[model samples]
Target chain A: MLSPILEFFSSDPKDKKLKKAVEHIIGQKPSNIMLYRLAFMHSSVSKETVAKGYKESNERLEFLGDSVLGMITAEYLFKKFPFKDEGFLTEIRSRMVSRESLNGVARKIGLDKLVEYDGNRRTVLARTSMYGDALEALIGAIYLDKGFQFTRKFIVKSILTQHFDIDTVVSNNPNFKSLVIEWAQREGKQIRFDISEEGAKHNKEFTATIYVDDDSFAVGQGYSKKKAEQTAAMKACEKLEIS
Target chain B: MLSPILEFFSSDPKDKKLKKAVEHIIGQKPSNIMLYRLAFMHSSVSKETVAKGYKESNERLEFLGDSVLGMITAEYLFKKFPFKDEGFLTEIRSRMVSRESLNGVARKIGLDKLVEYDGNRRTVLARTSMYGDALEALIGAIYLDKGFQFTRKFIVKSILTQHFDIDTVVSNNPNFKSLVIEWAQREGKQIRFDISEEGAKHNKEFTATIYVDDDSFAVGQGYSKKKAEQTAAMKACEKLEIS
Candidate 1:
């Protein structure tokens, strides 16, 4: 029923195909098809408009969607763990919305197929983060086409429940060092961690500085070497905008 | 009429005053008066519950409100400047929600009087940022009490429009160096900038590192000394979570 209605909205075969794909992914028909169309338009393929420095791309939508996603995740975690402190909630939210997590979600939902980008561009442009970014843009499109309530329901019901196992994510302890190493290996980048200690033996503090491809990325400090390394890895992941 | 109704809802004089104040500030009566009371709870005056680690305070609400405010600001900027790129929108939004800006808004709306905190504690705790934080917590409470649409309208109509002048914010050029210096003075922290230049004189690049209170805060790079310092100041501002 939804497919036929979507098909009736657009006679163009390409538009019909896009509408069907969107409906299939989001479990509903988009009110404004153009917003979803714009959401899928990566900057690589986006053409500059009449105004100089302005181009029709998903970047703006991605910006908006990022905030929307953050709010929803924050609220969900706030209610889910009633007794948890802000630090714990913040940590969990970051893990959930991490680049690796979003990329996995995007792939699982078959969003990679809908993303339109320049095929001839550098191979690195087709990296995993692109899928995650497109997922965010798609969320922005949903938010605009429908209001916040509908978008929140869609994200909570269709996206979070469908793609993410909340219990598993909450229970599993994240090892940032391992996560960063895995990312480095996949991206074929050289990653190194340097540690230094200071203060007395009884109260020594370790500082870890992370370097990617020989350029310093970020640094973190902890009481133990492992803790310091983990902190550094976490910071590096944030700085690299990976995981 | 509203005051008499609020008095009728609460027999306690303190509760009546609080309700009247909240109503006056937000332009509406709150459905859950307890939420508003929780929003004003400062950690300095907060008592831990029987749950041990869990405390009744506004920190959790602050965390939630921060995201709600972020999304509302992002959407507001997204719609207001359709032609502006994401970067521009981000900068302006940050400026609007900056510690200094929010503090000013909180004071303008007389939120400082409503914030509950330990009066005998360190004078720093009663500084400008507390009002800003309380403002955010109030926003979070409003979100939880009235839902997103009502909160959005309140933020736009009562808060944003009444407090912020959008045109002045957009037109003014931000000087990060000055901003950071002012913050350092206010916080009574020792601030220093170290710079290094490399490459040919014709195409030299400058790197600036900012240290606050004798600790390295952040670093930035640019084509000139002033630009490098400005960039460093901007990064330091973000690291310190100040304007």
Candidate 2:
């Protein structure tokens, strides 16, 4: 532990910055800063390794971290809802580990700030998934640096249980269509969702409009009818102030 | 350990049958027959536990086993391909854990004979997935009954390495369209896939026809254009003996 502090003064500016970032993200001092460094190394700037292989990027780490996340989440669900059916377990698990949820977690942990990448304009535009991918790679690094038991505790106590609100996640249906329909049914109000397709045969767009009691509530467009309905329902939910 | 053998001889006929099946599947003596029994019990015949909850079917076990499978597969891939990129790892992992692969593994393990489910005509149609689910549940039961190490050995040695042909799997592309296109390009043959939509708007269908050298080679159908193309490509591969 003292080594890190001692090295802090002697370490280069970049190393010091990385150490700080690692400390902030994990809430624990990093024992293997190299692994953490690799975790933040994006594939965009991937170099060659000694073995003529590409310099390791967060992708491999992301793969392992994804499994670790799934296992930990499954264990949590098994214990938390002992009597719940598999459907409930699967639904809750999906909510907890969804891309949107992970993106939020990544933002909260400031992973976007830590990532190192070199990219072109098109690549940069496609890197909306970078933060979440970095977060998973961080987890894989932690698992390797800290071991499985420590990683499990770190994730359960610090990440999932600490950062995410369980109640809100459970109650908040990402399937906005289902939520709005339930709300409409409870109030005995008529609700209709109309979806239409437009554009050329190869590149088509779907538009969905929601009507509540004969009043146009919201309109949304997407590449698919389901996505369009979801978008429209989300807008309707925002307008009506219903979860 | 001897208790299982004694119980097999003196127990009810059903318990005897279950024990026999369990032994056949795991290639070991049954230390706890109850867990194995639950592993094979489908939700269709679900009863009530003392807690008034639906007597746990293989669902929870399957959930746990799915994670176990993923983790084990990740570890295997990590060790097997030290320098391989994440994309390679992900593709192989998906291939190994795919439903078709799992179902094939389940069938090889004779899960078709062991699972006990009470179902009507419609439910029976869905039993195609039951065999694979039971196989996963059985894995979960082993993890609990024996330990992680033993479960790992069971999966890696008894199931994956022993039964699966790694070389064939690696060479075979699940993307039939890609495989067929590559073959067509090498052979200097012109090929085209034409897809059309059919059926009701909501319950839509897509059909695809593959033409090689301006002659119809194969026809296939699916719910989506991409799937239909894939189906047609698969048929073309079969007919042309191309992949």
Compare the candidates by DockQ and give the number of the best one.
1
**Runs in model 1 with CA error above 4 Å?**
A1-10, A174-243, B1-10, B175-243
Candidate 1 residue lDDT tens string, A114-189: 8898786549476648888889999999999888988899889877777778888888767788889888898799
Q: Native-contact fraction for each model?
A: 0.81, 0.73
Cα lDDT of candidate 1 equals: 0.82
Give per-residue CA lDDT, model 1, range B127-231, as digits (tens): 648888989999999999889998899888877777889999999867889889999898799999999986554546578998888877778765568877877
Q: What residue runs in model 2 are displaced by over 4 Å at the alpha carbon?
A: A1-13, A16-31, A50-55, A119-127, A174-243, B1-33, B48-55, B119-127, B175-243
Best by TM-score: 1
Displacement of the residue A169 alpha carbon in candidate 2, Å: 1.3
Fnat of model 2, as a fraction: 0.73
Candidate 2 C-alpha error for residue A187, in Å: 28
Q: lDDT score of model 2? A: 0.77
